[model samples]
Target: MPELPEVETTLRGIKPHVAGQCLRGAVVRVQKLRWPVPPNLSELVAGQTVDDITRRGKYLLLHLTGQTLMLHLGMSGSLRIVPDEIPVGKHDHVDLLLDGKRLRLTDPRKFGAVLLLDHDPYASPLLAGLGVEPLSAELTGDGLRSRARGRFVAIKNFIMDQKVVVGVGNIYASEALFRSGINPLRACNSLDSKEWNRLVGDIRHVLTEAIAAGGTTLQDFTGSDGRPGYFRQELRVYGREGEPCSRCGAAIVQEKIGQRSSFFCPDCQK
Candidate 1:
């Protein structure tokens, strides 16, 4: 699945091309997705201009004339800007037509979503209960510590909770915990103020660096320009199970925490 960094990269990549453009309508090649593509999507967006674009968690919000279009690039989805004459590929599912150009959505698994919202997007159920953005000022060491108090869940699972903190995916959580020298299996309440401070800082650092690198491309993720992310090159220990730990030369360990694969250096992360 495309994580926060990948979504952020896609937002930055496509904003320039789609933002401020007049949306003539859409061409729905397929109406079936994670949620059915609104049957009247084209009519809902017809003649409207895209005022701006923004991201909340993993969803992209295109602010239009009287409504908002929310897009989610599910497990294996991507967007690309191409000319109207370009031939559609097998996975090309939807196209939002602009002036001589279109923004194409390609989802091989059909788990992505294209929804039209007539009211405030923030209040929608899809985004209403979402947690704070990890990159925002709202995320603080004290805030996280407060949330973790008296929680016996694994620390990794706690941070991965969408209601606690948004966009901290499996890969990022693993990498951030390893960098902070915190074991993923530790109970959430086991962390003190000092540990919370370190974890918060490292999470921000890891996510910011990943966004700068255009996101980590482990499989089907790519930027709006159809370019693969290069952050995988700088990974410390996300998928390198049994690999040597860069900090202490000990073997990196992989375990199932909350049923998700977690990678950490047993020696470095205590």
Candidate 2:
């Protein structure tokens, strides 16, 4: 699934072309996605100008004057800019035609979503319950330490919780824990103030770097321009299981935490 960094990268990549541009046309080649594409979505957005484009957690929000379009890239979905006349591919599910250009959504797995919100999208159930943005000033070490009190969940699982902090997906969670030298299996409540501080910094660092690199292109992920991310090359442990640790030369280990793969340097982390 496209995580926070990938979603943010997509928001940045397509924002310039789509922001302030009026939607001349809205086409839904297929109306069935994770949830049914809102019928009459085209009518709702066709004449509106894209006032802004922003990301919340893993979802992208396209803001118009009176409404918002919420999109989730799902497991194998991507948004790309293509010429308006370009022929649609098998997976091209939706297209927003603007100023002779097109912002297209392609989801081979059809698990993505396109929802129309008449009220504040931030207050919508899809987005309202989400936790703090990892990069936001509100996600300080003290904040994390407070939330972590009495929680016995693994640090990896705790951080991955969307209600605790949004957008720290499996890959970034592993990398962040590794960078902070915290064991993924460590109990959330076991962290001290210093450890929490280190974790906060590492989370910010890893996410910022990933966003700069356009996010990790593991499998079908790509930027809005259809380019693969370069951050995978900088990964220290996420998928380097059984390989030598980048820091200590000991074999990196992989385990299951909350049913997701958790990778770390057994020698360096913990």
Candidate 3:
């Protein structure tokens, strides 16, 4: 699935073209997605000017004059900015026809979503329960420490919780924990102030680096321009199981925790 960086990259890539452009029309080639594309979605956005584009967690928000269009690029979804004359591919589920450009949504697995938000999208159910954005000022070491006070869940799982902190996906989580020298299986409540400080910094560092690299392309993720992310080339421990640890020369290991693969250097992390 496209995580925060991928979604943010998409928002940045498409914003220049879509923002301030009036929508000529909306083409819903297929209405059924992870959630049904709003029945009147086409009418709602037609002729409306796109004011801006932003991302919250993994969802992209297209801010229009009176409403916002919420998009979730599920496990196999991607948005591309293509010429209006370009032909749609097999998985091109929707398209927003701008004055001279086109924004197309391609979801091979149909797990993505296109919804209309008449009111404040942030307060909507889809976004209401999400936790602090890792990039925001509210996500400090003290904040993370307070949230983990009495939780017995694995520290990895604790940070991955959307209600605790948004956008810390499996790959980024592993990288952050590795950078912080925290074992992924450590109980959340066991982290002291020192560890929490390191963890907070590592999480921010990992995510900021990933966004700068245009996100990690391990699978279907790509920027809005259809470019594969280069961050995977800079990975330290996420997918280097059994390889030498970059920091300590120890062997990196992999394990399944909470049904997600976790990579760490035993000697370097605890």
Candidate 4:
């Protein structure tokens, strides 16, 4: 699944080609998507001008004349900007025809979605109740500490909670915890102010660096330009299980937490 960094990279990559372009039309090659591509999307988006392209968490929002199109690139989904004359492939589900270029959505598992709405987009259920953006000013050490107070769940699971903070997925949570030198199994409520401060700073640092590297390509994830991310080269522990730990020369091990694999150096992250 694509995370915050991948979505942010997509927003940046496609903005140059799609911004300010007139929407000549829309084509729903297959209406059956994760949520059934809105039946009236094609008619509603025709002849409108694109206002801007932005990202919230993992969803991409296309600001149009009177409505906003919310797109979620679910597991194994990708959006590419291709020439109009290019032929669509087997899994290509939708296309937005611009004056010059086109935007195409490809999803192998059909878990991605394209939605159209005419009301205030933030109020939509899909966007509502989402936790604070991890990259925003609201996600501070004190803020996270307050939320974790009296909570006995694992710190990794706590930060991965969408209601607590959005976009801290499995890979990022593992990497962030490793960077902060915190064991992934630590109870949330046991953390002190000092630990919270380090965790918060490291989370921001890891995520910012991942976005700058165009996101880590673990499985099916790739940038809108179809290029693999470079961040994987700098990862300290996420995928280096059973390898020598760079800091302490101890073996990095893996465990299943919340059904996600967590790689960490037992000696370094105590």
Candidate 5:
């Protein structure tokens, strides 16, 4: 799935081209996705200018004249800007028509979403229920610690909870925890102020670097420009299960936490 960095990368990649551009219309090749593409999507978006583009968690928001378009690139989806004359691929499911170009959405797995919102997106149930953005000012050590109180969940699962913090997916969670020198299996409330602070900083650092590198492309992720993310090459312990830890020479280990594969340096990450 496209995590925060990948979603942010897509937002940045397509915003420049789509913002302020009038949408001629939308073409929904298939109406069924993770959620059904709005039936009247073409009519709703037609002739409306995209006033702005932003991201909340892994969802992309295209602020139109009076409505908002919310998109979720599910398991294996990508957006691309291409000329109108370009031939659409089999997986190209939707297209937002522009003057002479189009913003195309390709979802091989058909798990992406295109929803038309007539009201405020941030006020909607979808965006309203989301946790604080991990990159925002609200994400501090103290705030996290407060939410973590009384939680016996593993640290990895605690951070991965969408209600506690948004956009920290499995891969980045492992990377951040590894950088924080905290074992993923540790209970969430076991951390002190200093450890919480360190973990918060490392989380921000890992996400910032991943965004700069265009996100981790372990399988199907790519920016709107159709470029694969390069951060996978820089992964510390996410996938190198039995490999030597980069910092401590001890073998990096993998285990199932919250039913998700988690990798950590057993020696370096205490």
Candidate 6:
């Protein structure tokens, strides 16, 4: 699945090309995605100029004058800008046709989504329920501490909770925990205000760096331009299980927390 960084990267990559461009048409090659691609999506988006492209959590919002299209790149989906003459592949499920160029959404696993929203996207159930964005001013040490007041869940799982703070996925969560020197198995309530501050900073630092590097290099994830994220090369503990820790030189370890494999430096992150 594409996490926040990848989603943000995609938004940044396509915004310039798609923003202000009029939608000539939309071709829904596959109507069934994670949610059914709105059958009349073409009619809704046709001739509308893209007002902006923004991200809330992992979802992308293509804002138009009066309509909004929300997209989720579930497990294996991506959007790319291509010339009109380019041939669409089997996985190329949808096309947003511009005057001479188009934005193509290819989702091999069919887990992605394309939905049309009549009103404000931020007020919709999808975006409205999300927690404060990790990069936003609302996410702070005090904010995290308040949310974590009585939780017994592992700090890893606690921070991973979207209700606590959005967009800290498996990869970045582990990396941020390692960077913050917090053991994944430690109880959330065990962390003090100072540690919460460190953790918050680490999450922001890691996420910003990942977005700059284009996100973790996963098997199926790539940026809009087919660029694999180089941040994976700098991972500290996410996938370095059983390998030497970068800081303390102790072997990094992995364990299941909240059903996701979490890696950390048992020595350094203690």
Q: Find the 10 residues in a row with the least total lDDT in model 2.
A: 38-47
lDDT of 5 by residue, 35-143 (tens): 8998778888898999999999889999999999999998799999999999979999999999999999999999889988887788888788888899989899999
TM-score of model 6 (CA atoms) = 0.96
lDDT of 4 by residue, 84-122 (tens): 898889988999998767899988889889998778898
For lDDT, candidate 2 versus 5, the one ahead is 5
What are the TM-scores, per candidate, against the unseen true structure? 0.97, 0.96, 0.96, 0.95, 0.97, 0.96
lDDT of 6 by residue, 132-191 (tens): 899999999998888888879999888888878888888888999999999999999899
Candidate 3, 28-65: lDDT as tens digits: 88998998987767787898998988888888898999
lDDT of 1 at 168: 88
Worst 10 residues of 4 by lDDT: 34-43
Off by over 4 Å in 5: none
TM-score, cand. 5 vs. native? 0.97
Q: What RMSD value applies to candidate 2?
A: 1.2
Whole-model lDDT values for every prediction: 0.92, 0.90, 0.89, 0.87, 0.91, 0.89
- Candidate 1's C-alpha runs over 4 A off are none
* Shift in Å, residue 170, candidate 2: 0.6
User: lDDT score of model 6?
Assistant: 0.89
Q: Global CA lDDT of candidate 3, please?
A: 0.89
Best of the two (1, 6) by lDDT: 1
lDDT of 1 by residue, 113-166 (tens): 999988899999999999989999999989999988888999999999988999
